[model samples]
Target chain A: MTQSPVVRLQDVTKKIGGRTIIDRISLEVYPGEVFGFLGPNGSGKTTTIRMMVGLMSITSGDILIGGHSIRKEFPQAIRQVGAIVENPELYRYLTGYQNLVHFARMAPGISRSRIDEVVRLVGMESRIHDKVKRYSLGMRQRLGVAQAVLHRPRLLVLDEPTNGLDPAGIRELRDYLRKLAREEGTAVFVSSHLLSEMELMCDRVAILQKGRVVDIRAVRRDSESSEAAPDDVWFDVERPEEALRVLDGLGKGRIEDGRLAVTADRKTVAEINRKLVEAGFSVYGIRVKTKTLEDQFLEVTRGESVG
Target chain B: MADFLRLLQNENMKIYRRVGTWVMYAFIIGIPLVMSLAIISVTPEDPPSNWLFMFIASNILASLIAIFTVVKAADAVAGEFSQGTIKLLLIRPWRRSSILLSKFLAMLLFGLALTAAAFTVTLVVGTAFFGYTASPEDMFSEMGRKNPWGYMLLWYLYQFISAVAVASFAFMMSAAFRSGGLTIGLSIFILLAGGLITNLLSLLDKPIVKYTLFPHLQLTSYLDGGPGPLPQYPMTLGFSLAVLGVHFAVFVAVAWLAFGRRDVA
Candidate 1:
């Protein structure tokens, strides 16, 4: 999109005692984008988010938000950022509105209207005045988002935003986050173990394993080749044996329900189709099954366990 | 300066929002009024001096205020960590030192407010029963410097200093521990047992007891010209203040070091 980066992490590394928790990692999050951070359990995802917001100290390297360095100029850097680490830990004694007001008072120049605007933006207008202890987990999550965006932060960071949400709540959060990025142009940096949600929500995702960024990939349509690898393509032909014979060069063909299923890429599938037509076989239909995000995630992190 | 004020305001709001805070305020004010009523009912003709009445009532209420201060101070930082609100609190524009200082100042303000409330109630109840009469002799039995206003001021000052010591100790514990309940419990134990331990040590007639923090907390005895808690071991007000001052600084320093370096996970 050629937009200036809203958040930048440069060669960040963290060491605890004698063990390194986060190895050198560098990335950027631009405005109007939802960037996903994916990692296995104890892969330093939370630690990295903590360092970004200055909740935990960075052993080395720097994080810049809107060109302000977090290590050297924390107040200036953190001023443009809002975050909720782990869970939204709010005061149960106060109302959701009160919680927002309390946080707004800390951030400079946040007017009452801004508070109201964020409330409406998060769709918490109906129950904003209710005490937080009475609100559900989903409602609290929404309130957390409202508080984080009260000052219209340039970047919003959330660690496991959909931890305890139900399916409907997850969908609502996903849609709201997308809308937030599109409408407000706030760069969102979210970390989660839910690969499906990350696939649907994020424009790009960085996968980490053993405290290292193993891969950075574009998600959804931005991905150059969703079918670059071979997939199972099924063909319903007049003679399954003939189709199997025609596709035998590509991969092993298995017959199921009067159809020949063969593993091949798009090019190979097209070549097989052309070969079948030339061989005088009636090919009624050919369907290519695409791989889901879960399948890809499993393949990428084949040996590692995901929390 | 505005940022500091906002941090203080946020801390104040967090404190005042708790039902426990209001209940504490009520207890501080209510207990004094209730005591005055009982005393008035018992003594029909005795004309107690307003100053004396307030002095006696506040002296008793000061201990209660100390307990409340301990509770408030103990919850200042540790409660935030336990409730997970520290994450939100620390992410603001203010520095951790500023946030910690604000929470400490708010707890002090709460202690001051409770002390003021107790003093005001004592004044009101004493005036209602005995009229506005300042009897220096009735209040101060020690024969030196019979200025009633100065004496009463020193009494309140002593009570406030004691409150600060207890609050600082609790605040240090708060910064050191994550569990608010444990902090409060340990503080209460120290508040009561620490005094007893000092007194027990005083009975040993050792010269080292003079340096302990508990003995120095009794700055009131110096003002009253009394022999003090340990009659054999005497201390000047300056010496006592120096000792308490050292303890206060140590407590605050420990709290700052612990809070500044905490990982905040």
Candidate 2:
């Protein structure tokens, strides 16, 4: 929290042909965090990202990267970031290695060894010399990731990055993004409709509807920094009724599904567990029931078509 | 400027890596060789001088070169849109104007390399088959040009300018419309129609013919200090060049405006 935000959008608006596509959206993304962007179809997630990366014009206000305005200082603002606006549309005629080399020439100071490093990192070594036309959708996705991180950018922006990835490839992309953020302090801004995928990969999420941000909140309730937050924790034990009564004073515990469900923070819940054990109550299992992102998404979207 | 070169390198890689581009270059080099050899075989006893063959072969090759150049220019900007690669290309640190300029320069370089290849083959084969004569300068000295080599050089320069004008027109269309086929078709139409309009307009005595682009399209005629290819106009070479220059500026202005202001979706 001490460091400045890596990306900040100030009342950014986009109007195309007299219709507002994005209406005064504002937020900030800091270093070493994965910020998820979510919206139904035609909700303007792609338009907002287009403006942030300097692909589209900002009708009002501004998008800043590393404190430089994208409108006035595009080269300066965009220089610190790497982005893929939609699909990773690369040249299909050239080899994957040639495609990487072609893009590496556009940015400054990207060495040959660095291209090799990214190729290896993305697991494209064996097919790096093959033509991209021969690559599968998932292989193209991996190559897309390789190119986006080739310059070691401070901020990485991806739109629908997991569109065609298999389960294993998607998992690899998630881990790679986390590693990039953790080790390189890169702030990742990603948009995907897979609520479950975003729930697993993102640190925090901003839900967008009708060209507006409706909510921004943490993805996981068990984050230590939010230890004071009362999460819905369930405990399965030998005596659900007796255990519920033992912790009744500390929290509002009730028996549901023949288990004790309590709304309490980790600290107070730990205290309740100690008291239960001291009273000869055996605790068999403990789990934090995270509210599914799909539920929250549908709740915020008001059950509208996810288009 | 160094950064600009790297962008140019990227554009060049995209251009030359295509198999179709190589085929275009092949026609450029191959057609001239075959034509020169045909001339030698048909009239082995007394073929025309090298300068004469050079002049005849150049006229045919220039039209082909212009078509090829315009095709590449049309693809320079519109191809990115068709391939959906413009988004990835534009998100870099460089300005939009810089990216466009790199593509423009690459198209021109491709044209230059093709023209140079055709010129070398035509001249080399033309001289070997027809045999060079020392007194050919006298034959071509009708319009105050005494040096045959210099005269041919001026012809090539003027031909290149015409090609530039055609490519610029094609480039403007593609940049503004984001449709390569439309630009290519329209440019080739204009190129072929210019010749027909020139012949048709010469028959008319109207003063409007003086300002028509068809008269000025063949810029090489002004090398003789005459009234140019279409003598009905009697306009100076400077006036013709000025017209082309103004048109060039207009094409570039429209291209820059459309490309710089467009919001790529």
Candidate 3:
């Protein structure tokens, strides 16, 4: 909590052709944390990332990487950050090792050993010598990760890195990103439409809708639960129909697998349980199922097509 | 400075790593060697061969270098955009200008390498075929310049300038367009037809052709202190240089501005 943020975007805005692509969104990503950026198809996730990495100009506000402003001091600010905007965008003709070496030359103090270390870190030792054109999408993605981390950047930003990856590749990338955040103490910022991946990989997520930061939620709910609804409470009882009858005032109840499932807060669940017990029903068990990020995202960005 | 060198190295790596680049190099060297061999084989037993003729023959090879330079420059920026590698370059610590300048320098070096290769081959083969002696009657003084070797160097200087101009135009197009094929195709068209268009315009006698880039690109005509290739052309060497300089500046400015503002989506 005390560590200073590795990246800070203060009221960043981008407008193109009289229409705002991103509107005054501000957030910070700390070191050693995986921050997820989630939005629908045209919700400005990539636009914000492009602005952060200096690929696109910010119409207003600024992004600071390691305390250097991207607009004012682009070279210095970008030196502390490594990013792949959309795809890996590598030189396909060159070998994967050559691609890494080519990028490493642009960064200061990146030695041969460091390149080797990153190559090993991404588990691309065997195929690093092969041409990238010959690499599979997964291999290219791993090579991308290796290239992005070669300089040990303070902040690593990847936009849709897992777009074309298989499930195994996505898992590998998630594991590697976590390792980078934990072992290298690098701040990892990734944007994805895959809510499950974001749930598994990120520590905190910021949801964007229509160029605005709609909500920033922690992936783990234990630290903060106020924003979370109580849960869908399911009760296993001797008499499901009796339990449902006792829960008439609550939300709609469904009986499945000899248990009653009802959407309720903690107090309502307790009240239902007490009523069921008083009404001659054996309340064997009660389970509260917390909502996943997918459920919350659908609820938050309701009525908008995911695109 | 060190960073610029690294950028140049990266550009060079990308350039030379392609199989097509090697093929272009081979063509530049191979075509001249074959032509000189043909000339050597067809000489009659009477007339003495002149080595300067080989240099003259090699002078035509400059256009080949120019064409190659045009294609390389056309691919330098636009090709990266097409292949999506520009994002990798754009995200680096170097400025956008640095990345572009490095690519330009790499293309320049490529043109120079081709020119150098052709020059070496012509000189070596010309000496071997003609015994390295200049016949007084055919001392290349009729080419309107004495000292054939010095004249050849002057010819190369002018040719290099023209090649730079062509490549610069192509580089500008490369920055402006996302399609490498479009950039290369349009540049080759311009390079091939540009001079003819200027000559056609010159016949109109409207004085507008004097300011166009094509006529001044024949810079070698002014090397001999003569009236240049087009006697009807109304510009002096200084005027031609100024015009070419203006075009070069414009080409570079267009490239810089386009590249700086382009959204690398």
DockQ of each: 0.82, 0.69, 0.78
True contacts kept of each: 0.84, 0.87, 0.81
Best-performing candidate as measured by lDDT:
2
User: How would you encode candidate 1's per-residue C-alpha lDDT over A1-307 as one tens digit per residue?
Assistant: 7988999999999999989999999999999999999988788899999999998888998999999999888999999998989889899999999999999999889999999998988788889999999999988898888888888899999999998889998998899888889999989999999888899899999998878888888786535666667778898788787667866666557787767888887888888888888989988998876677677777788857776
Query: Candidate 1 or 2, higher DockQ?
Result: 1
The TM-score obtained for chain B of candidate 3 when compared with the true chain B: 0.92
Off by over 4 Å in 3: A221-231, A236-287, B44-50, B143-146
TM-score of chain B of each: 0.92, 0.92, 0.92
After TM-score superposition, the amount by which residue B95's alpha carbon in candidate 1 deviates from its true location, in angstroms, is: 1.0
Query: lDDT: which is higher, 1 or 2?
Result: 2
Can you rank all candidates by lDDT, best first?
2, 1, 3
Candidate 2 lDDT by residue in tens digits, A269-299:
7887898899898888778877799999999
- State how far residue A211 of model 2 sits from its true place (Å): 0.3
Superposition error at B139 for model 2 (Å): 6.9
Docking class of 1: high
Off by over 4 Å in 1: A1-4, A222-232, A236-244, A247-271, A274-285, B45-47, B136-147, B227-229
Locate the minimum summed-lDDT window of 10 residues in model 2 chain A: A220-229
